[model samples]
Target: MSANDTAAANTGSDERADFLQALGQHRHFLRFATRDLTDEQAGQRTTASELCLGGLVKHVTSVERGWAGFMAEGPSAMPDFTAMTEADFAKRVDEFKMLPGETLAGVLDAYEKVAAATDELVASLPDLGAAHPLPKAPWFDGDAKWSARRVLMHIIAETAQHAGHADIIRESLDGAKTMG
Candidate 1:
C-alpha cells in the first residue's frame, strides 16, 4: 500500500478502537454503579426521576440495540415512534423500570452480552461511512442523515450520559460511588 493508503488504514483502526474503548469505559462504570445492590435496591428509584441502576442498564441495552439496528439495516428499520399508542408509550416507559422478579444480576448479565455483541458488530463493520437517512421524529431534522460511524459515536455518548445518571442513582440508593 502507498503511504497515504497505510495512513488511512491506521486511522480507521484507531478510530474504531477509540470508539470501543469509550463505550467499554462507560459500560464498566455502569456495572460499578450497580455493584453491591440487591434486586430490590436496583429497582428503587432513589432519585426524583424514574432512573435506577438496573433500569439504566436496560435502557442502555435498548438504545444500543436500536442504534445498531439502524446501522445494520437502515432508518426504515427503526420503530415508528410517531405511531406509538398510549399503551406503546407506557411500555416504553416501563422498559426503564426494573419490575418485580427482575434481578440486578440478570440485567447486568444481559447488558454485558449486548456490549459484547455491539463490540463485535463495530469491529466487523465493512464501511463506517455507510450513510442512512434519519428517522422521522420531532427531535430529528427533516433532512438529517448519519453515517454508521456517527451512530457508534452516538451510542458512546448515550452510554456515557446514562452512566453518569446511574452513578447519581447508585449514590442516592446507599451512598455508593461509581467514580470520584
Candidate 2:
C-alpha cells in the first residue's frame, strides 16, 4: 500500500480502538456504581423507580448481548416482543430486578462476560460499516437501518445512560456516588 493508504488504514484502526476504549470506560463506571455494596444493598430500590444497582448491571448485560447479537446476525435475530406471552412479559420485567437467587457478584460477573464478548465481536468485524434493517419499533422511523458501528455506539449510549441512573440510585441508597 502507498503511504497515504497506510495512513488511512492506521486512522481506521485507531478509531476502532478508540470506540472500544470509550465503551470500556463507561462499563467501568457501571462497575464502580456497584462497588462495595452487598447483595442486599445492591438490590435496594432507593429510587421510586424499580431500578437498582444490581438490576442495572443485569439490564446492561442483556442490552449489550441483544445489540451485539443483532450486529452479528440481523434485526430478525431479535425477539418478537408483540408475540410474547404474559408470562414472558412478566419475566422480562423481572429481569431488571435483582430478585431472589441472584447476587451482585453473579450479576457483575455476567456483565463482564457480556462486555468481553461484545468487545470481541467488535474487534473481529471485517467492516463496521455494514448495515442491517432495524426491528419494528414505535420510536424508530419507518424503514430505518443501522450499521455495525452504529449498533456499538447505541450500546455505549445505553450503557452510559444506565450508569448515570445507577449512580443516582446508589447515592440514594447509601449516599454513595460513582463520581466525585
Candidate 3:
C-alpha cells in the first residue's frame, strides 16, 4: 500500500479499537461488575434511594433505549420512560415488572437488546457529530441537543456510574468483592 493508504488504514484501525474499548470497558462494568445476586439480595435498599442492582439494570435499559431512539430515530419518535410514566415518581424505583421465576436473566436480556441496538445505531451513524434535540422533559434547564457521539459516551458514563453503585450494592449484599 502507498503511504497515504497505510495512514488511512492505521486511523481506521485505531478508531475501531477505540470504539471497541469504549464498549467493552463500560459493558464489563454494566454486566459483572455490578451483578451476581439473588432478587432478594438485589432488592435490598442499602441507601435511602431505591438504587439497587436490579433497579440499575432497569434504569440503564430505559436510558439506553431512550438514547437509541434519540440518535437513531430522533427525539420526536419517543418519550423517555422517566417522563412518560408519572404514576410512580419521586424515588428510584425498580420500575421493571418481572414475572415469576424471573432471574437476573431477564434484566440481562433487556440490557443486551438495548446495547446491541444502540451499538448498531452508533456504528451506522454517518457522523458522530450529527445532532438531535433532546426530548422535551422535566429534568433539563432548557431545550437541549446532543450529538450522536455524546449519546454513545453518555451511555458509557451512565452505565459505568451505575456499575459503581451496583458494586457497592453487590458488596453490601454478601461482603463480596468484584470479579473484574
Index of the highest-lDDT prediction = 2
Weakest 10 consecutive residues of candidate 2 by summed lDDT: 75-84
> On a 0 to 100 scale, what is the lDDT of residue 82 in model 3?
52
Q: Please give the CA lDDT of all the candidate structures.
A: 0.87, 0.89, 0.70
Clashes of each: 0, 0, 0
Lowest summed lDDT across 10 adjacent residues in model 3 is found at: 90-99
Which portions of model 2 miss their true places by more than 4 Å?
A: 1-10
Query: In candidate 1, what are the lDDT values of residues 1-180, reduced to their tens digit?
Result: 999879978787578888999989998998899887789998989878988888899989888988988988888878777777899789778779998888888888888888888888889889999989988777898789999899998999999999999989988888888898
Better of 2 and 3 by lDDT: 2
Better of 1 and 2 by lDDT: 2
The TM-score values for the models, in the order shown, are: 0.92, 0.91, 0.78
TM-score of 2: 0.91
What are the candidates' C-alpha RMSDs?
2.8, 2.8, 3.8
On TM-score, the candidate that comes out on top is: 1
Badly placed stretches (over 4 Å) of model 3 are: 1-17, 34-36, 80-85, 88-92, 96-102
Instruction: Note the residue pairs that clash in candidate 2.
Output: none
Clashes of 2: 0
Better of 1 and 3 by TM-score: 1
